[model samples]
Target: GAGVSQSPSNKVTEKGKDVELRCDPISGHTALYWYRQSLGQGLEFLIYFQGNSAPDKSGLPSDRFSAERTGGSVSTLTIQRTQQEDSAVYLCASSLAYQSTDTQYFGPGTRLTVL
Candidate 1:
């Protein structure tokens, strides 16, 4: 089965611009999550989705950050009016289900750099 995949592994963008990062979860996995880890910091949860239910977007840093999961699989995280603080590794993970203790396998991540 295919593991989670993210494109442009590294992205360099200008401040105040918008960028979209894509994620493809593993096949048959029912849960997907987005997290960001700043330099020397632990992972910060951004959003999570399970099946066709409403996604949990509580962890999004600000209104400028938004995401959507489609067909219970692929998801896209979009940053509107990107800021310097938004430069970090955007990681995507998936588990068999949306359980608090479920182990999540992570992708190499898309590193976004705001210039």
Candidate 2:
């Protein structure tokens, strides 16, 4: 992909449902990241993947949240038993290198609304 791509740009789900958001990072990039942004809150890192190393899941909010990056490229973020408070924009970014912060590019984001 040329840049990060997120599916279902807008998702509206009833509380307690599960949702899977997808991200396709740029080709040849080795670093991928997921972030969540609430209405008035700044972006919060959810996870980070670099090559075949263990993913950094430090930012995931709870046991209900999980993610996976396969083939060191595509990634998926899953939120189980979503709640109204879970409504927010999920963003994905990718960089060519783990230290290439200047090269990170963000996706349009998947707006999840649990109502």
Candidate 3:
């Protein structure tokens, strides 16, 4: 059984450039999540997807951030007109069920550096 994984371990971009971070959740997991961690800060919830239900995106920082889960397996998080403040490590996680009490397995994360 594979654990959650992310791509492009690291990224460097101009301040206004856009970036896409990808994630692959473990098989049989029905709940997926996206989070961000700024340099020394704790993880910040960004979005969540559970089965066929609508995604929960209330945690997205602003309009520049968005994500999508395809086939209920892989997910991508995109940042439009990236800003210096958007520089952080983007993490992904998945759980066996949608319950808030379920344990989430985390990915290593994609680090984005906005210059």
Candidate 4:
């Protein structure tokens, strides 16, 4: 019975490099989301996945950011051509569903640093 796990707790990379952050959500979770927390700004939602389909990707800051969930379990957030502004703690969360009442369970997060 694992909660949620994210790999490469700390990622340091040069500017313009691509990084893929992985997340394994709890079993049977149908809703998965990718979020980020940066300096000054509070937590921001990047993408939401219902099963393997991303229905609400409006939160993605730009086209360079994308996410995907497979088999309603695992998910990945890919940052293409990473930038200094993209440096933040990438958080992955899952819930019973996408309803407002559903409590979200978050992972430890992967801290990405763009040098």
Candidate 5:
């Protein structure tokens, strides 16, 4: 893809089920991030992966949420035991590196709806 892209633009899952969202970043970017946007909470960061370094998951709200980047390219965000509160637009972004000066490119986001 030319820029950051996400899969399954909209997902509707039942409560207690699990869901996985995918993000494909720019060809050579090294930094990837996951964020959640909801009516109750604005844009909230969930995790960050910079190169081969361990991902920074300090922003994750709960243990049920997890994400990973494979081969420094595609990334996946998994939500276990989904709840109504988990309904939100999951966003992904990538930058050249994990530097303050790097500009991040954002994806369209995956809208997850827990029923």
Candidate 6:
């Protein structure tokens, strides 16, 4: 009955540093997603994982961004050489399935600030 959760509610880092954000999706959910919201901007999809299918990395902004889901449960998003523009709230969501109409439960995001 637990909902999606994220760690390190806030993070501050210097430009060029690297950061890793973690997420735990709800039990029994088979689809997970990562998204980012910059200051004053809308949510931008980052990546998606569904069951054993290959992850969809199309939403990643650049090579500096990457993520992985293990055992179809926990997930981590890694940012390499963080940039000032990377400051944003990284959100994670999960659904029961990967259907387009399925409702996604969102997690409290991890806020990253790059100085």
Q: 1-115 in candidate 1: lDDT tens per residue?
A: 7788998799999999999999998888899889999999999989888985545667889999988888998889999999999999999999888897878988889999999
Once superposed on the true structure, which residue ranges of model 4 sit more than 4 Å away at CA?
Answer: none
Give the poorly placed runs of model 1, Cα more than 4 Å off: none
Please list the C-alpha lDDT of all candidates, in the order they appear: 0.90, 0.89, 0.91, 0.90, 0.91, 0.93
Which candidate do you rate higher for TM-score, 1 or 6? 6
Q: Judged by lDDT, which candidate is best? A: 6
Output the TM-score of candidate 1.
Answer: 0.94
Please give, for residues 1-115, the per-residue lDDT of candidate 3 as tens digits.
7899999899999999989999999999999998999999999999898964545678999999988887878888999999999999999999999997989999999999999
Candidate 4 lDDT over residue span 1-115, tens digit each: 8897998899999999999999998888888888899977789988888889998789999999888777778888999999999999999998988787999999999999999
Every model's Cα RMSD, please? Answer: 1.2, 1.5, 1.1, 1.0, 1.3, 1.0
Lowest lDDT block of 10, candidate 5: 49-58
Answer with 5 or 6, whichever has the higher TM-score.
6
Model 5 misplacement above 4 A: none
State in Å the error of residue 36, model 2.
0.6
Q: What is the clash tally of candidate 6?
A: 0
Whichever of 5 and 6 has more lDDT, that candidate is: 6
The local lDDT score (0 to 100) that residue 100 gets in candidate 3 is 78
**Model 5 whole-model lDDT (C-alpha atoms):** 0.91
Error of 3 at 69 (Å): 0.6
Clashes of each: 0, 0, 0, 0, 0, 0
The 10 consecutive residues of candidate 6 with the worst lDDT sum are 51-60
Q: Tens digits of per-residue lDDT for model 6 on 4-113?
A: 99998999999999999999999999999999999999999988999745457889999999898899999999999999999999999999999889999999999999
